[model samples]
Target: MFKVLLGVSRWNFLSLTVLTIALAAVTARYQGAEIQQLQLGLVLLLALCAHISVNAFNEYFDFRSGLDLLTSRTPFSGGSGTLPQQPAYAGVALLLALVTLLLVIGIGLYLTWQLGGKALWIGIPGVLLLYGYTQYLQRSPLLCLLAPGVGFGVLMFLGALWALGAQLTAGAGVIAVILLLLCSNLLLLNQFPDVEADRQVGRRHLPIVWGLVPSAKLFAAFYLLAYLLLALAVWFGLLPRFCLAMLLTLPVFLLLWQRINKALQHNADLVPALALNVLLVHLCPLLLLLALYWSNTATV
Candidate 1:
């Protein structure tokens, strides 16, 4: 039961939330905001609970819908096959989802009361997305594509900044947008291997609605736009030049772009491309986080 809960929560993937909140904290410090350690910690907890809730909800819904049975599991795509293998634990997954969701709501309410009602602007939509993603958002091609990005980038990242008591500067906005694009593309590419299964389950993400080729193109376009946004933010003095460290992933990005088309046709290439996409998603934010922390410390 414990193992099944961990699988449903995608414990390994929770690091994404850690990186995002760390980035937000560093960005807040960079903007001259004094970090409130307790608030930041609570915000981190909130984000983690939100992520776990969504993953559990997804696992339960997909398993109940029979989507997991149809998917050919991959390292990156497909629902975690935990419940399907241990059907008795399906109720446990639902209970975990509800428990985590309640935790999220409780933490969110606390943050809002401590921080301000403005927190609701991010929290409400975040809760909605968390609950609706697998059940409803999957039915809309555009929403399905953008939901993950928005959840991680805007709600988690920017919301963390707000919770940390930072003014939402232009630099932070640009960073959030970059994460939004990259995170969206992360889910976009992962969908490639699941296209058929997702379609069978009535999911209409870009890979199904737009076809793999066009979806791949959009994936590339999103990465290009994110990189361009990073460059532009630095050029306009919106983000510090140090943030350009994200460009260090350019080689990997190029490799991903080159392999995306072939990945559509070859399973051999698809896994590596998916791996690279995940690398970029985590790497970019990590680099930016380090850059911001360095910049903040350098001045003090």
Candidate 2:
């Protein structure tokens, strides 16, 4: 059971779920909205199940593509390397993903019937994008990078909205959309190191397609944009004043940018993986702070 769980790649799947929960809770709290326990539990279950499915499917496919052939892939390989590098059977992982999909489809279908158009039309597609992301688009042009942002905006927000059975405010929805694009761009920059290996397997990532200089510039551009959005998120009255405290993340971001820039100049592999981990740690707390702030402010 533990091995199977590890095969699912919690960092890729579960981390997003945790991030989503925090974002939704923050949005709700700022509005003084009430949260439901039963609903939140179901939402979380759906997120985890789908996340695991994506990870498993990604593992199965990246292996099929020979992406695990690259050495020095540890410390990062973006989570799919574990099963494939070990020569684990994609068949087993594929089956697990299917089981998770069916379970979620069942729950999502019920939620749709009970909840209506938004859940099915909006929510399900949000979930389905994870498939397009890992399975197909991860190798596309800019699409590879853009896909994650769309998932962040669509899947995370829709999931939270569905879970609460509440209509999302325009402000919260917009904030989530910007967050999605910003964070997704951050994720793309995170893939810079894997570009070579991914290309060796015909993955053609943006960083690889554009080359190091362009990729690094694009990454730096987005990194700045992300901070701007965080600021705007506070200035616009969408979140509490304390949310501005996320600015404390700036120094870390600058450090990462410098690292990535240095890596690009020298064509080093360490920057992408190290930078991504740094970003993850930086953002997780900001999201959690927002969530906790929301929880404290909730009407109960």
Candidate 3:
């Protein structure tokens, strides 16, 4: 049952949120701000709950809408195969989503009260994205791509800094933007296999709205822009020079793009690209974190 719950929550993808929040908190440390360990832990917990809630919510909706029934369950793209196989899990998934959402609300309120309304600005949209995304936003082509990026990248990143009582630095802002693009591109790539399934259920995601060929090109462009943001951030002294080590992931990024482009028609072939993109997303930010930590260690 716990394993089934993990599948329903798509727990693997939760690292994207965790790593970005860690980057923000680490950036706060690099900026010489003191972060309370308790506060940071709470914020991390809040992020995890929010991510879990979103995943479970998506799973519940997808199962009910029959989208999960139609999708070819790829490790990266399909709704967790849990509910489809064990329909009994549907209620459990929905209950967990709601319970976590309430926890999100409680945490958001506490953070807002402690940190001021800046936290409120982040919380409202975060909740809406988690709740409305499957039901509303996924039906809109533009928001389908933009909402996840903004929620996971910009809001979660900035929210972590604010919660930790750190001023948002220029470096933090640029990293947040990079995360935004990475996450957006992540959604775009994952949506490729789900295009037909999504379309059947009235989801107007990029792949469905713009033919897969054009969507693939757009995904490639977004991937490049993420690297561009990293480069510009380093050039302008917004990030430590060691941070340029993020470029080490370039070969994987390029190979992933090539595979994605070539596999537009081959569903099974696209899985490797999806797997590679997941690695790139996690690796790039993690490398940035390590670079900053090492640079800090060296300076001391």
lDDT of 2 by residue, 1-300 (tens): 456557655454466566666666556655566777877777777777777777777777776777655634544445555565466556777787788878778777777777776667766675667567666686687777777666656666656764675556655655566566665665666576676677777776787788867876776676576567666765776555565566666677677777776666676766464746446544844653564464445321
Best by TM-score: 1
For each candidate in the order shown, give its overall lDDT on alpha carbons: 0.88, 0.64, 0.85
TM-scores of all predicted structures: 0.97, 0.86, 0.95
lDDT of 1 by residue, 1-300 (tens): 789989999898898999999998888888888897888889889999999999999999999999899988877888788988999999999999999999999999988888788778998999999999999998999999899989988899889888887878788888888889988998888888888988887888887888888888888888889899999988987877888999999999998887876755665558888888888899999999898988844221
How accurate locally is residue 168 in candidate 2, as Cα lDDT from 0 to 100?
A: 69
Give the range where candidate 3 is weakest over 10 consecutive residues by summed lDDT: 291-300
- The residue pairs found clashing in candidate 2 are none
Superior candidate under TM-score, 2 versus 3: 3
Off by over 4 Å in 1: 265-269, 296-300
Error at 262, model 1, angstroms: 2.1
C-alpha lDDT (0 to 100) for residue 137 of candidate 1: 96
By lDDT, the better pick of 1 and 3 is 1
Give stretches of model 2 more than 4 Å off.
11-13, 78-80, 85-88, 269-288, 291-300
lDDT, ranked from best to worst: 1, 3, 2
